[model samples]
Target: MKTLNTRLDNAIKKLYTAFHNNTLHPECCKQCAVGNILDNSDSWKHFSDEHGSTKLNYVGRVNEAFGKRFNGYTPSELLQIEVTFLKACGYQLPIHYKNTKPDTPTDKDVLFNGLQAVIEFLCKLDNNLNVMDYTKIFDKIKCDFIEKSPVK
Candidate 1:
């Protein structure tokens, strides 16, 4: 029999792929919960460096309001959440090109690995996860953002 962790991991992978393929929503990223957090945080540089100061400031304010919910998660766990959230929201992980040496993995490769780590962590967090469990987590994340997000 498969372990609960294995089941959850499989479910999250399926959901992540569905989200990535736009089977859920085509424009989900524009209003994504985790995307909003990353777009507003200093860590956004890890994904994209093109944001202007004003946009970054806006992201900062958003983070100020919602960052506390993620206080205990490790950086890697946070990255997983961000990647999962982005995929579920119908967005693509940005392809960073900083370490493309022959032996090193590309940005896409790193992101894929990150996603796998996230699945493992999430699966371990709950032993009785269903496919909708991640969606519930996503909803909570979204609710936190919507509740604390500043006015446009």
Candidate 2:
């Protein structure tokens, strides 16, 4: 069994490459968050007819019933991650062309936002801390331990 940390690391690396290569796209099954996590496979699209729908389709339901986990994420988790990514990137749910989207879908900022959201969700899935969260670094406090030369 692959650990969730390993899966999360691999997903983050794949997403980083896709984002830097300008290949990540909300409309592209093979370049979206779930696709990248699944090694750029579009098979995840079979989970649902709508891009951001959390409701699993027949295929997805069967997969879930079989305890299918792609890259350590369940069928429903995949949908939620994609929806979170799309929403963070400023796209409306279901990803209709008529729906709202970032002014430039390929913009670094937009993709970064999407990636960040996905990473956070992935961490949440495993009950792990968000690796991208730097706030904890700032929370670190230095404590000085005093040595006692003698005890009375």
Candidate 3:
């Protein structure tokens, strides 16, 4: 049986390859929670210049953001797994904000908070050494994970 880590690794590679090959739509990525955070944050360029990929930087950022570690999982490995899991569960990028209101937080802020919540939940599960499928967990929490605003 393939280990969860192995599955995640393969998934990450596949997505990254698709993206680089132009098979994955750039807009799709921009909408994804992970992609949105990486693209908008300073970490994108910093990590890209250092690791050659923003995806790897995300893993490290999770560690810094949460102050926790997953056993037997490097930052890169964890990020690949998380991204793969998120994509498999059909999470799309957040709606872009117009930033019309300077005082109020933008859509990106809300989305980033939501993504952080999801990551924190995942990390807690990982820290507990739970090996269940990520999709199941996401299904249980997705409604709350991604907040929605009423359409005008």
Best by TM-score: 2
Deviation from native of the Cα of residue 39 in model 2, angstroms: 1.0
How would you encode candidate 1's per-residue C-alpha lDDT over 1-152 as one tens digit per residue? 14445434444544365446433221233322233323323444332233111122444445545653333333334445555544433244442345122232223444345344445546555645433346788889999999999989
| Candidate 2 C-alpha error for residue 14, in Å | 1.4
Error of 2 at 138 (Å): 3.0
For each of the candidates, the C-alpha root-mean-square deviation to the true structure, in angstroms, is 17.5, 4.9, 16.4
Question: lDDT: which is higher, 1 or 3?
Answer: 1
Where in model 1 is the C-alpha error above 4 Å? 1-70, 95-128, 131-152
TM-score of 3: 0.23
The C-alpha stretches of model 2 lying farther than 4 A from their native spots are: 1-4, 141-152
What tens digits encode model 3's per-residue C-alpha lDDT throughout 71-110? 3344554445334434333334221243122232223443
2 against 3, candidate with superior TM-score? 2
Worst 10 residues of 3 by lDDT: 93-102
